[model samples]
Target: MTDSNAALNAFFKDFAQNLGRLQKGADVIAGIRDSDVDVGSTPKRLIQRRDKVELFRYEPEVEQRIDTPVLIVYGLIGRYTMADLQPDRSLVRSLLAKGLDLWLIDWGQPGRNERWLTIDDYVDDYIDEAVERICRETGHEKITLLGICEGGVFTTCYTALHKERVRNLVLTITPVDFHADVDDPAAHHGFLNVWTRSLAPEDIDRMVDALGVIPGEFMSSIFSLMTPMRSLTKYNVDLVDIIDDKDKMMNFLRMEKWLADRPDHPGAAGRQWLRELYQENRLFEGKFELSGRVVDLGEIDVPVLNIFALDDHIIPPTCSKALAAKVGSSDYTEIPLPGGHVGLFVSSKSQGALTKSIADWLQARDG
Candidate 1:
């Protein structure tokens, strides 16, 4: 009788607590507004504009400790806004607080009219122009080039070709060897690499020709397929678990906002990305060309800082770590952070380490 009574009391307590949580969750959901979930709230000023491409310099938060300005080059696939998602959890803010002068290129939303834009145009023209402008503005002969993902490929190529213009090179989650993922021990790692290699060259041409630009929706769908289980359960399971927590809910909504704002990739660039880089693996093989000149990775002799997420499924550790052997830099340094691709920038656990590592590395070479 005593055992039965205790069991009944425990069950009732759990049931009551669950009911209270459900009520709180409902109230939280009812109160959320678009303004309450704002992201990329860091202050910045646009300093240069060319067609759809714009360059912005972040306002310094402290006395600039580094004389050389650091230009952040984010991939065209995703917006640079990820670095500045929120004030407290921002890579931008943290770097600024550390007294680093920061600037970034915003490859503003590409459309049908921008379909003809190619990798050559981006590397030789736009990035070059940005570098020249930064040099003139800061009166520094060479500026540090910090690239993320695909942008790292561009910066690497740029550094190789124009070694005189770059003082330091920093790459985060950048894949130097597209085919390296085949050796990844984790089964789910490098889904993009496998999927891209599966498609024929003709298939890429057909898709680009038909669409003129790869729709953001199509790219988002591909990313979703990379983690099918997570895609299915994210809303129903993940969101529900944190619905009553304001901080977690805000983070979730901000990420969703960022994900939803994916820009359509220009057709010509998309074809080259999928074909020459992904399918043929030309970039790693030293056959990839930008503006009629071959991009040889070994030609990049600048002090290189390569950062990779240990469990990055998209880029994969093997793909990113391969840079250690390929670069000619005697000062090559690698940091393997714990988390997924996006988590390296946004996760609270990873942000402090990521920012501090970058600041300390850059400061060491600032002279």
Candidate 2:
């Protein structure tokens, strides 16, 4: 016979244990971006806040700083903070500490005005507009554009749509080619295509109409199903570990905070992207048209650096490798890392080597 008190104690004990885990911050899980943190008396240079994207520009103090200005384009599907996730495990921080001048685009939470915004709005209106702004402000003719994941697709389209404007392009863990099988074997396998497509415009409209913003958890669940084990098992492990870590707990909370955020994907824009990019694979074949211009891969005349993760389940090698043949630029090169899709930017194992390689490659071409 088991003691009733011991069983009840166990249930209540875990609740207390959960409280302890909530406080320890580990693995640099804190979501504070270095740029946003105002360290007392720290010299600040150029930081421009845009209506859509926040620009964080860090000036280099090293002698003879590189001439080419680097602009980072993070994925829009998630928060841009992943690049600067941890204090030690950040791409932007690492780049800045190395004396590289940088400007990052933080596409702010989309509002009602931005509803129905499409890839065209991202590539043509915002990115193109940002490129011109950066060029004019920095007194540079061209920019070294770096894009990741869906952001990479946006960048590639920008390169194709506006061939002459970009100097050098760097794609990190980008899904340049998504027509083939997904990198992950367990992903939804087009379940989203069917479900999202089957969703009537009114269905989408009813939700967004009822709710001012699209629920973040709803969007996250869609992505989380890609790796069922990740959602099921990862949380269990965290429950045990986070029992005593408030900071870690907060860090977890922050990531959860970011994960729960789901700004509405404009109804019209979402339909086009889901149908064209994912459904029909129009980007590679030059069939995609936006704002009266065709997105031809052959128009990518600038030098390009494509980085794909060998072990990434989200964007397999095939997804990015198609860039080798699709581009018109002779200066195309590809680097495949051992990290996963998001690990290319956030994980500790890849940060040092990957960031160095990126900077070195850009420097070689720009020089």
Candidate 3:
């Protein structure tokens, strides 16, 4: 090679190395932010979803036994505790402060018994049972279900199947139409059609039989790839800030704890989601079957409120906004917030505005 060419190659090599260093540094910092070590621990209560499912509960309420209770259901992939971070910046606390009785659905660590847990089992069996229990406890026929992201679809499915149990419905950052033009295929590795659809119930069993519980790390890694460099960049940034402020370091550590604390999703439901929602676009098409029935959005007739983030990477507008069209609830309203998927619930910016808006939306249904 010529001398000029060699010099230019060396410069490019150094630039590549530097970029790698920067990304690695940030990932480390971001990991720190997502941990239990950095951020102060949250106050959580344990609720028995069944005799076994130990759902975590966080109540920041100074008052109790209100007229209409609030139930917050998080996505199956991530721990529910993400919504209950710091007291000063908590969705649970904010709802409680608004004088609403609150209950959070923490789907807890699933075991082998939960291995074959289908989306049917979750929406029909677990959620329906929980709603029934909550209703009996409060003596109210209906309860407000606030579902976030993937949970929103689950909630909508439940409402459609059993509208009698749901009074007011709230869906935030949920993806109903995975086949939307804007939905990011980056979240899943292969084409939604071939790989996921090829898998049968036996396939899911074998995959889980080989590994006791599917490692949350595998799922987290996929999410990290969506913003390949962001996690690394945040880690480096956290370390630098840790040099000066102790709270920032603590906060960073706490976030890392939460981020790392991903619970495994049951393989069967995962396979179904991959095949039905992502691959075939069943839910939006009114062909998504759960618990022996097709999911027709027209069946979701209760008062519904949909919340979307202006820039949610995990779920883009197409994934979230599609709900506006399918649901039969003419009493529907959509609120778009200025934040990313994760930031929509946790950021300080959401505290003053979006959180209050959430409570206000719930309050109108309190009567």
Model 1 quality (TM-score): 0.95
RMSD of each: 1.7, 5.6, 6.7
Worst 10 residues of 3 by lDDT: 188-197
lDDT of candidate 2 over 1-367, digit per residue (tens): 4799889989899988665545443333455453443211122354666566666665554643457888888755676677766666777777766566677776777766766677788889888877888888889888888898778888888888786778898998775555655444546343443455455656665765655445545777877886678788767786557645555554565455555654555444555655677666778767888887998888898999998887776667777888888898999898888777767776678878788888788778765
The candidate that achieves the highest lDDT relative to the unseen native structure: 1
lDDT of 2 at 320: 81
lDDT of 3 by residue, 1-367 (tens): 9999999999999999767766665665565432345232456576665844544445455765346766788877887767766766667777777777777777777755677788998899888888887888778999888898778888989999999999889888888877674335544322323344455756555666776455688778867766667878885664654534455655565667789888888767876776678767889989999988998899898999888887776677667788888889979988888887778877889655777887777766667
- Per-candidate TM-scores read 0.95, 0.79, 0.81
Worst 10 residues of 1 by lDDT: 35-44
Model 1 regions more than 4 Å off: 1-15
Clashes of 3: 33
Task: Quote the positional error of residue 196 for candidate 2 in Å.
Answer: 6.9
**List of clashing residue pairs for candidate 1:** none
Per-residue lDDT of 300-349 in model 1, one digit per residue for the tens? 88999999999899999999888888888899999999999999999999
Angstrom error of the Cα, residue 70, model 1: value is 0.4
